[model samples]
Target: MTVERRVGNEKIVELLEGVSRSQIIKQLRPVGDASSAQMNGGSDNVVASFKELIKRQDETIATLNHQIKNLTATWLHRKRFVKTLNEGIEAERELAKLKQEMAERCQIENDRKQAEQPHIEHFRSASLPAVAEQWQQYQIAQLPNAEEVVVQQLSAQVKQLEEQLTYGWQSFEVQGASLAQTSAQLVEANRKIHDLEVQLAAAMSNAATVEGARSQIRDELRKQALRMLDAMLRFLDFITLDAVACYTV
Candidate 1:
């Protein structure tokens, strides 16, 4: 059986044994008295003594029963107290575990924020201002007068190169005898073509550079937005954890 049941049974057995011993003592004393009374020819006194012994045994049984009741009540009270204490200890353990988890989460968030601090500063101090300046410059370059001037300059150079190349071919065809002069003109035309190509390539490279800058700006903006959202989420989590801790307390 269970430990409590076993202990209660042991106590009951001990009490019953005490009652049996007391009954045996009373019985023996009365029997001895009756034998002496009989020997003295006192039958009435023997009967009266037997009645008194019975009354005393009844009183003793009642007292023992009362003591058993009191002991049982005390045992039950102690059992309840111990159970309540154990439940309280378990609750304390659970609370401690929850608090530890909250602390760990808070530490992780703190570490993440610390790690991102440099990127945040860089975005604010360098990336943002640089993007703004580049955007302003791009806007200025897109103006009607400035665009037209650039286009016209490139077109004029192309046209001049084409005219020089046409003149050099015409000279070579019409003045075959003046080979050296024609050769010089052709060389000059080739040089103009190469210069024009170089200028075109440079323009294309500048356009690519501007595009790359814009892409970098966009990427930086995206990263900053994500960081802001993460920070807000972390703050909300911290507040929630704090509220939970307070409520648990």
Candidate 2:
């Protein structure tokens, strides 16, 4: 058997079929004609490459997950903002309706002098002057000082309602802006993540193809090595058979 001992520890023996001697024996080996020590040290390189690939894949997945989570959070935030705005709008509408009803009732009461009505009986007190009480009490009345007082009260109420509406509008605008900005950010982030994943997948596929080609080349090299070893074994076999035939003759 002709053993090609390139790497010192490796024992590449004859690879004849059904032979007593074993074939190639190597834990790890470099393809090029490098030292055994160099080959042994280089196992770390393959390990490092695999680790890097795994790390990249993990990073890509994590980035994509974070983007998706951020988008979902933004969606929820917008939903809550819209719900709150709707509630505020409904409340404002009810307040406006109440104010309108109150104004209408006051107008109806003032259209005619109805002092004897059951509604105004409790609004007026016995100790107050008739005109003074009438002026101070019913939001609707015909008096010199009544219009100013009514105007002041209505103005205050309207101002308060206006302020509330303004606040609601400002809040809505701010939330809407936040939603728009968040949505845009989410979209951009997702796009970047998607691009990264595509790149990662392509790189991994390329790596796999390269590894496949390398494996095929290695297999062919091993086959050639085996054939060489087989020739060596056949030479030893021919000598043994010739010796046996000569002894028998």
Candidate 3:
């Protein structure tokens, strides 16, 4: 009876131990499963975070490239505008020189006419004495031949003066036409310069606006990257703690 009672007590202790071990295993199973799920969830979160960061970085790079392209185009346009402005200014200077040359030519022509006037008067004075002598002879003799010779000489002198005046007037008309054409060209150049200036101003304004947008986008990207890094760090910390806890268990 004593041995049998001892055996029955041993069986009861074994059954109790088995029940406690099973209960512990049941509790540990859920914990292990939960830890495993957390690890998997953390891995997924990290991967997603990295992917999102990569996507944002790519977008930022693309934005920077776009901004660079815009800046380059603006710079090229400005260079072209500057070149055009320089060319216009040079053309204006050339026109001014042409006008100065025309003025000098007019002054020279006037001086030449002034120099010739004295000689013309001297010739008229010298010829008048001869003409007076002829006229006196014709009056004294009352001869038709003497009167005819004096009349022919006077008509020739008048014809020569009329020819000189006609040539001077024609030259003046030609010079006037050339000056008018140059004035019209200068006015057109000025109009084109004004248009180019307006275009440059508009381009500068557009560049400023684009730069502002690029800066704003860069700031947003920086903020987003920082947020992603912080979340990744926190996730890593959570995984580390979980690993340590599992090891302890």
Candidate 4:
């Protein structure tokens, strides 16, 4: 029984020494100092890289947002320009319609005057002479008031026809000037619309370029993140090895 107790104590002491050695090895492991320095350096490098990546991403996002704002502004301008162009076109059409109506009315007036001109001249040259001859034979002294009344009526009709012709000519000239102005305005609107279209196309191209740049930045960031993850995995593997070594010791 005493031999058994002695052997048991020796086994217990051996176990205790093994446990102590494991504890000592764990405490003195190379995870500190040089190993920790390397790990910390790697971690710091990874953190710095991530910070740089985040900054670059933030810059990229800001640029993208700025580009979006510009694009939106450009689009809005294009829309308003198009709307104005359409309004201009509509006004031009309306002006053209007015001009056409005015022309038709003038043409009708001219045709009526042309049809009446020969009759008016015949009445003045032929009928007036005949009436004057009849009045003279009948003796104008006996019917002086009758001759005066006929002459006054013919003179008044001539004055009225002249006034109408003058007014028609003035109105035609005004309409002509208005039509010319409308034509000029239409041409200017078309030119502006064309310029705006060109600008819109350029803006679209710039937006595409910005999108491509953003895609490249995202791809680069993803690659960097993957590299950082691989580096962390390697660091973890190193730590695991150290722990295994301490256990074996």
Best by TM-score: 3
Give the residue spans of candidate 1 off by over 4 A. Answer: 1-44, 130-249
TM-score for candidate 3: 0.36
Worst 10 residues of 4 by lDDT: 1-10
Per-residue alpha-carbon lDDT of candidate 4 for residues 95-164, written as tens digits (9 for 90 to 100): 9999999999999999999999999998899888899888775775576596786687779988876776
Going through the candidates in the order shown, the clash numbers are 0, 0, 0, 0
Model 4 TM-score?
0.35
Give the per-residue lDDT of model 2 (tens digit) for 1-249: 122212112211211222221111222323444454544444455456556656766776677778888888999999999999999999999999999999999988877557546556655654457877666577456556877888888899899767766765665566557556656655665565566556555555676586665565556556655655565565556555545644453
- Cα-lDDT of candidate 2: 0.60
TM-score-wise, the better of 2 and 4 is 4
Q: Model 3, stretches more than 4 Å misplaced?
A: 1-38, 124-249
* C-alpha lDDT (0 to 100) for residue 33 of candidate 3: 53
Q: After best superposition, candidate 2 residue 200: deviation in angstroms?
A: 99
Clashing pairs for predicted structure model 4, backbone only: none
Number of residue pairs clashing in candidate 3, backbone atoms closer than 3 angstroms, sequence gap of 3 or more or interchain: 0
User: For residue 143, what is the lDDT in candidate 4?
Assistant: 64
What's the TM for model 1?
Answer: 0.35
